[model samples]
Target chain A: MDLERPLPTPITPECRPYWEGAREGKLMITKCRACGKPFMYPRVSCPFCASRDIGWVQASGRGRLFSFEIAHQILNKAFKVKTPVVLAMVELEEGPRLLSNLVGIAPDPKQIRCDMPVEVCFEKLTDEISLPMFRPVGGAR
Target chain B: MSDLARMRELSNAVGIVGVDESDEIGTLPGKSQLTLHVEAITNAARDAGIKVSEIDGVFTAGQHSPATIGEAIGVVPRYVDGTTVGGCSFIIMVGHAMVALYHGLCDVAVVCHGESGRSGVGVSPRRDTALPGQFEFPYGFGGAPTYFGLITTRHMHEYGTTLEQWAQVAVSTRKWAALNPKARNREPLTVKDVLDSRPVVWPFNILNICLVTDAGGAVILTRADRAKDCAKKPVYVRGAGEGSEHVMLTQMRNLTFSEATQRSGAKAFAMAGVKSTDFDHIMLYDAFTSGPPLMLEALGLAKRGEGVHFFAEGRSTPGGKLPINTNGGGLSYTHSGMYGIFPIIEATRQLRGECGARQVPNARMSLVNGMGGMLSAAGTLVLSNEGSR
Candidate 1:
């Protein structure tokens, strides 16, 4: 993917690992040893227990579509060409949900429903950044 | 003791003495954010029959600081607060102002909000480096419509809420807008009209979203004793609560429900010793059509997934069992970025019986709720004209 129109994520110390992992086609989540729980949106401490014993674990890259929107307007100018995109919230089997885009599926209400099975597919946007977007498993392309 | 029992001292302790808005709303081409603040605050002081020098406390949020507002308004306030939570920041300021007055920090407190949301004169800086911009914005989650649309989609999935049900909220609010002479879009809207409007995002069309217009309003609070001498009938602050559990949308406890509202409204209702039925008028922030229903459900005004029916059944519209958003709401009324103060202004009008055409008949109690940061923070106020003395 050579599109550079949309804004890029500014890698920070806390979230660098998650972005780096996406480049390597890996989905990452923060797991806390103290609470034995997993969560998304990397943070220094466990959101559940406030424990500093946090570690990065490879997510299953498999989840169900929790909910989504078929945005008719292209919010970011970079993605101006991709009008009517499907923005989705995928709830990983690990009990945490993350916001991402949905590919390999039509952006239609009649076609999409909640709890649809999906799998992560990394798409490199820049040399240092790759977004973890999801697609319907064993569904349309 | 119950929260209500413990709240007796605070209940009716601080009364809202005055409410005012900037002279120009919708499109004030030359007016900047700072000017709007000073204009609204000055008008509020005049409404209360007080002078700018007498306003010892100054409160404001969004794109401006209290120090700047105080300097501009010619007040060297003893108490100042700049709580910028989001669109609901001014509402949260009310709760803070009440606390400050209760603690004897200030006698005359003025909470103001102004935004060049439409003119883009002095908007707040974008936090692209922040959590949402870094994580969600990259995925095309740009503004309120996209995220709120996601919320509405989830709500529909969980409760089997139909698109028409969501459109009904717009229809009912438009009816109220037609009554409000100052409402931006007073034209009658139907369910089909909402459903057929330009699509901004899934589960939402242009009509389902709030219009971005330049506007601002202010509320003045003082000790109940002093309120008796004010120019307007004192609308006592019967109960107030503010809650913030998360700053990001993904971190909410539940996507289908608003925890902030649940927490804030519970405290407000308990402190007021009243239930949903006690309110003669209600004002839930309608930044999006989905907001009112979600707030209603969270505040226990409606059962889970039954909020949309409150409108579909005509219970929340004009001449219904419950009246809400009589000022046309942010949807049809003026929405200058932070809309928390607009509802406060309308609620005050209801309690004072000053709303000419849109008044809730014999209204003595009004509930006003404001939400900020993608439903991240919530502030609830129960105002009453009945038991101030």
Candidate 2:
């Protein structure tokens, strides 16, 4: 494991809700009240039409592994043991694409395929920090 | 779109005279990026028969950079650029440098990039990790190789593009690299080799990934008139364009191909007044295996799914119809992680009639497509011999 770990931020004014919800093991996606389009990388405004009328809503966190890559790279010293890791882009049940990690799949290449269904799980890192991750759902909900 | 005159007008203003790269590039053990870039710039200047002091502008690429290339090279350039798009940065540098030169911002502009990526410079676990990086590692989107693999798979699903076509890209470039010793994957590779290679990411075998060598390439651009006396023969920048939309694949409207490549290539083709089929040579960027196929589709070389067909028929290999990646490209040649510059280097050599065995005979016009980010940033340049226009 890496000694010099890189931790995420606290639930501050801008990103409080996201961190807090992750701590509660729930997924939240923001939407623009003006446009009703969902978005990831939570921000104060809608990136589509540039409307600031945004609101937070609970997301089912159910999605599919639309596309993914197997990373053999050890990004940090803490991650050396976990070289050849799998990272992915999950298209959420809501709409926006989320940059989240995948879990619960064999590291072997044949274990995954495009458009595979996955569900989100929160992994707590430091105090006040949790990440929304994904894993293949063996069967339906 | 009668930019044919405009392309000529741009060529009349600026031309890229010489291109050079550091021989001992990539993971120089303890060498810093600055030293690599300096050596590359000096080599380029020397190859162009000019002094380092003549350069007045420098452009650097990538966001997580230590400093501007000019400052590190000890030159106080009149123009300093820190255009931070990942791999395709050097390509945009050409377009931006030309614009800067057009208005008389600088003379002797040098576009430079070097990273110890293969040597692994203080590279982080991707800031998005846990947020995305660490969080996704176990589920398979491990690195760029597989990240691109995901995109390639989608392309395959939607367009009927096949794995064999993607393999053709790797095989073709390796054939070129087999001849050029600097290429990392010069060993013979076939479609079967591509199919059987260990899977780094689904749809991408080890051979499909670009070589992560650490090297720096530099190109010197000067006013058209000054280029006459600079070196052997100058390759005019006939047309150039750049496009940017999203930084990550998640944010793009679609993941199959790059809007940047589409937009940039459109503008370049329009400006050059030549269709994609007109180019005698192509130096497409291949950061990952999927970059070219998607880019080829977006750049209008092959229709969406037709890119696979183009490759399947042997249209892009050397001595083939399209004759691409003649300098072995990133797939076969030095990837340095930032493989954008090598395409330009090869294009310049082809224009100057210097690529000995690999030269495309009578090659007059060429096109180079550059990509940055996960196809977030793109630039296309049309180069031709001085009198072609």
Candidate 3:
């Protein structure tokens, strides 16, 4: 097993708030004040309406497994991930999708299904960063 | 005239005069990226029976600028395009060169591509601090296989596309590879062989992915009038189109279908004034086994959810109704990271009846579609040996 430290997310000005919320065990996303639509990966403006009146808001932290792949090969040697890691896209209840890791379950095709309910959980990586991951809604943490 | 009419007038206004690959394609560890570019450019110019000095326009994509390539090749190009939208940049450059030729911006244009995909010679080190690097990479998103596999997984969930159907593409393409001496993997393949291959990602075996090698290719184009004087048969550029959607997979409008493919295919088909049935040969980028089926459906070449049948039923194989990826494709032939130029070269060769064994007999019209990034961009070209009406 490679114990190399995983690459850290380079926090941008627009995404700092989302990372800050993750440290506090809160799921935060941006919603457009003009269009009343929510989006992810924290941006300064709403992608739907091109409005800069977007602001950060707490999300439900609930989502569905939109799509995923169980990777048996790792491209980046710095990533300290086990083989068969479930790399997935989770569609938040707030409507935007997030690229995240699906954990707390066996990485098997028979065990995972699309549209399965999932909820966000944070793992603190350092003093300032926590990654938001998802698992089956009722599965063991 | 309206914009549509003027756009239609540009159809068949330019034709491809020459096309060739680097002297040695499969694995040239000794060759640098720029060396591959120069070799392909020189070979293509020689094939066209023109001096490198006659190339007035230079177009290319990748780490190096067009000016650098033009300078190294001893050409002072008046018009140059450095459209680096990924692998499909070369295919898209064909369209740009056509417009440049039609407007007399340059008389002869050469679009070049050379990548040290496997050798890593003169290759630029990529550092991704962008949106994808910040978000997706942290989740152990392993390069192309995992990125493209997400689409296949979602397609399976949405439309019940099966693993067997995906393997069919690999099996069919290998049959074509067996005929080309230049192909990398020429052994006979079966659906069973594909299914039994090592797993890289769920729903994808090692056979499902494109081979990583080092190669370079170039295509020369000129006005239709000047094409008659070229060394080879002029493969008329009947129509061309290019488009893009999103940089990240999550931002893709729909996981099962590609909006970029549809947009580019529609524009190309419309400009050509032909239906999908008009093509005698077809070549869709096969970065993964699932690429052709998804793109076939998106391009309306096959009915929705039935694109896999084109390969599974052997309709796209040699002697089939619609021969696709006749050069063995990126899967079995050579995928030098960016595979866009190889398809153009194959289509041009097929149209000229130069393909000795794997030739599509009487192949008059051909369609080539290329995908860049992770289904982020697309470029479509409709070529015909017959001149414009």
Candidate 4:
């Protein structure tokens, strides 16, 4: 286990609400008021409509595995995890995709399939930050 | 005039007079990053039979600024472009230079690249507070292989692309590498060898990734009228285009195909008034095994979900119907982090009939596509040996 694992420092002021929501076990994403479209990685403006009239909203935390890769090698020394880390892109039910990890399942290709149903689960990395990860909806179909 | 006609006239106005690499590529601990840049610029200037002071425009990318490179070379260029998108910045610079030259922003433009990828000489520290760091890095998603490998995985899931097909790219590219003495990994490679190689990420063996080496390359461009007085035959710029979709991998419109390549390639083809079938040779940047296939499909050279077959069936090999990556490519050649410049260099040489052993016979026209920042940006150039009108 890498005890020196690096945790995210929320440098962007717009993303502070996201970290705050994660701390509360609530998956948060931004939705544009003008276009009514949701987007990932909260920002001041909407990507779809270029509207600054955007606000944070609680997500369903339900998504499907869009794609994934089982990493046997880690590039960053600060990334502390067991071998064969499952790095994945999850398409949330709210329509925004996220870069996350798949937890509560073995990092094996035979066990994971694209479009598998998943639900977000948070891990408390620090007192202030809880990483929102995903896992098989019902123990790996 | 129509937009396409205007583009054609602008593209034809400029041509590459000289292209060359540094004194030596591959591990050069004795040289700094700036040294590599200066050496490549000097060599290219000499190759064009022009003094370094004669260059009126400068373009470059990487940790160093164009101003810093210009000062080191004692050049006060009138027009300067420091477009640092990623590996493909130099390719886009070619397009930027064409516009600058057509408008008389500068007469002689030189685009330069030099990276100490292997030696760590004067390499800048990566910023961990950027958008990717804030969103993706927290999930242990760092490095190019992890990010790019996902695209291959998604491609496989959607199109039923096989792991063996990806290995075929490595094997076929290595075959070309064996023919070039300058290629770093010239030893024979087989499909089985690629599969047996250690897995860095699922669907990606170590052999599927690009090699890390220290290298630099430069290209000198001037108006078509001035190109005739240069040392070598000018390779005319028939068409050039650049586009970008997103910076973060998660924000990509589609994981299976590169929209960036599609947009840039469409503009290039329109400007050149040429179809995909018009080119005698092609050079698609191969930063990873998946790059060639993905970009091929995006560029319309092959049908959707059928690009991998180009390599799997040996059609892109030395004697294939269409020759691709004749200089071995980033996979087997030296990939110094930013590999865009090397493709431009090789395409120019192939059009000049200067490639000794791997030369494609009677090669007249070629297409070069470069991707920057994990498919975030793309630059395409249609080049020909035939002089501009």
User: TM per model?
Assistant: 0.97, 0.88, 0.98, 0.98
Candidate 4 residue pairs that clash: none
Scoring model 2 with DockQ, what do you get?
A: 0.34
- For model 1, what is the error of residue B177's alpha carbon versus the real structure, in angstroms, after optimal superposition? 1.1
Q: Number of clashes in every candidate structure?
A: 2, 25, 0, 0
Off by over 4 Å in 2: A1-13, A70-87, A101-113, A116-118, A121-131, A134-141, B1-8, B62-68, B71-74, B120-142, B387-389
After best superposition, candidate 4 residue A33: deviation in angstroms?
1.5
Q: Give a tens-digit lDDT track for model 4, residues B1-389.
A: 88877887876778999899999999999999999999999999998888899998999998888898889999898999999888989999999999999899999999999999999999987655667677888888878998998898999999999888998888888878888878899998888999999999998999999999999999999999989899999999989989999888889999888999999999999888889889999998998999999999999998878899889545788888788888889999889999999999999999999988899889999999999988989999999989757
B-chain TM-score, every candidate? 0.97, 0.92, 0.98, 0.98
Per-residue C-alpha lDDT of model 2 across residues A1-141, encoded as one tens digit per residue: 332223443233545676678888988778889988888777777898899888888899898887666666543444443655566778888887776666777755567676888999876665666668888887422
lDDT of 3: 0.90
Better-scoring candidate (DockQ), 2 or 4: 4
Query: Residue by residue across A86-118, what tens digits does model 1's lDDT show?
Result: 989899999888888988888898898889999
Give the least accurate 10-residue stretch of model 4 chain B, judged by summed lDDT: B125-134
lDDT of 3 by residue, B1-389 (tens): 88678779989999999899998888889999998999999999998888899999999998778999999998799999999888998999999999999999999999999999999999987756667666877788757888898899999998888999999999899989998999999999989999999999887899999999999999999999999999998999998999999878888889888899999999899889999788989999999999999989989988878899889545899888889899999999999999999999999999999999899999999999999988899999999999864
lDDT string, candidate 1, B142-179, tens digits: 77888888789999999999889988888888889999
- Local distance difference test scores for all models: 0.86, 0.75, 0.90, 0.89
Show the lowest summed lDDT stretch of 10 residues, model 1 chain B.
B124-133
Candidate number with the higher TM-score (2 or 4): 4
Interface root-mean-square deviation (Å) of every model = 1.7, 4.8, 1.5, 1.3
Among the numbered candidates, top DockQ falls to 4
**What TM-score does candidate 4 get on C-alpha atoms?**
0.98
